[model samples]
Target: MNLSQNLIHEIKSLIAKAKEGAIRSVDHHRTVMYWHIGERIFNEEQQGKNRADYGNYLIKYLSEQLQPEYGSAFSYRQLELMRQFYRTFPIANSLRSQLSWTHYRLLLRIDNEDKREYYIAETVKNNWSVRQMERQINSQLFERLLLSNDKESILAVARNEVIPTNPNEIIKDPLVLEFLGLKRESAYYEKDFEQAIITNLQDFLLELGNGFSFVARQKRIHLDGDEFFIDLIFYNRLLQCFVLFEIKTHKLTHEDLGQLQMYVNYYDRVEKVAHEKPTIGVLLCADKNDAVVKYSLPENNNSILASQYQLYLPTEEQLLKEIRREIEILNKNDE
Candidate 1:
């Protein structure tokens, strides 16, 4: 190409890159600005201790004056949200530009600090969108982790750079698969459920939680001149490992665990790179007994897990009862 032509191409590329960067910078500035505005509003609101009603009135008056000048961005609800946003994240420097205003709004709704921080770290680390963050929070991701890990370990995972060192750190014992939209009593084959997971793969991966990316479905493996097919394969970027899944529509059995172990061994020996961590295996089934899972696997079983999958969203009462039961178990064990 001629020098002038090359120069024009380079100019166009630079312009496009600059425009992208400018847009990102503007968004970052806007996020920080809103955080500061929230802080100011919260401080002012506290100053009127006796007139508890003053905050609402002030927001209304501000909206009236700013709406025409600032457009919908300065609406009463948005300003109120900004105030709450500041209350949620008191430190301005903690505001992450990767998370949009919508994400902060969702985070503010979570009352527990530990849970909120867990979601924040996971969202930023996994690059989750606002919708994904909301879904995970609603699904009780923190509670699930707490159930699977000790208090100190769970808190450490939530608060620090220490990535999960074992499969149990990231795996949920009973995975809620309501996102698949399968009817509760639907007479579906295991293959059907597997196919649905593959079809709605993106949603499934989100439901699977952080670090998971689809690798293959019904992946073929050859062993000792014989062939076997693995149901689903995923690679978790956070764990730096491959995940092999076997789907079952019935109660879990020792054979199922044995089969998964073999697959895990095969992947670790033949498929896993030298630098990568050990391969993890999961048996996703309809129902599982903790005792069965415990006795079936080896004493130091960290690479293999058995998790139950639900077809429908549990009732609120049932969910609450389950949470209570989990808490009770933890309390009893503590004694």
Candidate 2:
């Protein structure tokens, strides 16, 4: 390239970096300002309970006063959201710079502290845009994670207070495939679904949860004279192992589980390092039988898991029901 061309490119890159920095600075300060407003309002509300009670009147008055000077951003409803933002995240020091006012506003709606904390940690870890954050919340990522594991363990992992010790710790049941933009009415093949997942790989990785990176698609495996192909391969740095996924367009069967087990064993014996943990295999199917899943695997099996896949986002109630059902079973077993 010519010197002039190179110079122009360098200047453009520098300008882009500066613009990004300026945006971050504006967002961080805006978040802090909202927090301060929330803090002051909360203190006033506390004093009101002991002395005078302004209640809704105070918020309305502040909105009126602030809007005249600060513009429409400080409207009555927005002010209320800021107050909630402060109430939900009491400690100022805990706020992340990467997140903006919009991020906290969405987070404040969650009544569960552990769920809120998990979202915060994942938001930062994933560097998710505000829109991505909203989608994840609406999809009930926290609640879905609860379905595959104990509530306490899921909460602990989400908060970054504890590392995942096994595959189930990072795995989620009924992996949501809404991002793939596929309709259920049309007849589909496993490769079609696999291709869709690859096309929307970024969203797929997010749906797969944290610490996942794509390794291969239609990954080949050679055992003696026979050659086999796995649909998808992902490596989880947190789990320190490769995660193999096989796509199935129909209900899972015993033979399907056996195939995945073989893949897991192949990866463990051949691909995995001695220090790394066992490779985790997921048989993602349209449907699965719990009884078949239980009987197919050994008594102490953690490496292979059967998870159903849905083309649409799951309702929060659906997740809650499953969690409650699992908890009830555990309680019964305890008794």
Give candidate 1 regions above 4 Å deviation: 1-20, 158-160, 222-226, 237-240, 268-278, 312-320, 327-335
Clashes of each: 0, 0
List clashing residue pairs in candidate 2. Answer: none
RMSD of each: 3.6, 2.4
User: What lDDT does each candidate get?
Assistant: 0.83, 0.88
Task: Summarize candidate 2's per-residue lDDT along 1-335 as a digit string, tens digits.
Answer: 45798889999999999999899999999999989998999888877775565747778999988999999999999888888888878889988998988888888888887888778888887889999999899889888877767668876776677889888778788888888888977789888999999899998988888789999999898999899999999999889999999999999999999999999999999999988998999999999998899999998998999889988888877887888888887889799
lDDT of 1 at 19: 100
Best by lDDT: 2
- Report the error of model 2 at residue 309, Å: 0.8
Q: Model 2 reaches what TM-score against the true structure? A: 0.91
Off by over 4 Å in 2: 4-14, 44-53
Q: Tell me the lDDT of model 2 at 245.
A: 97
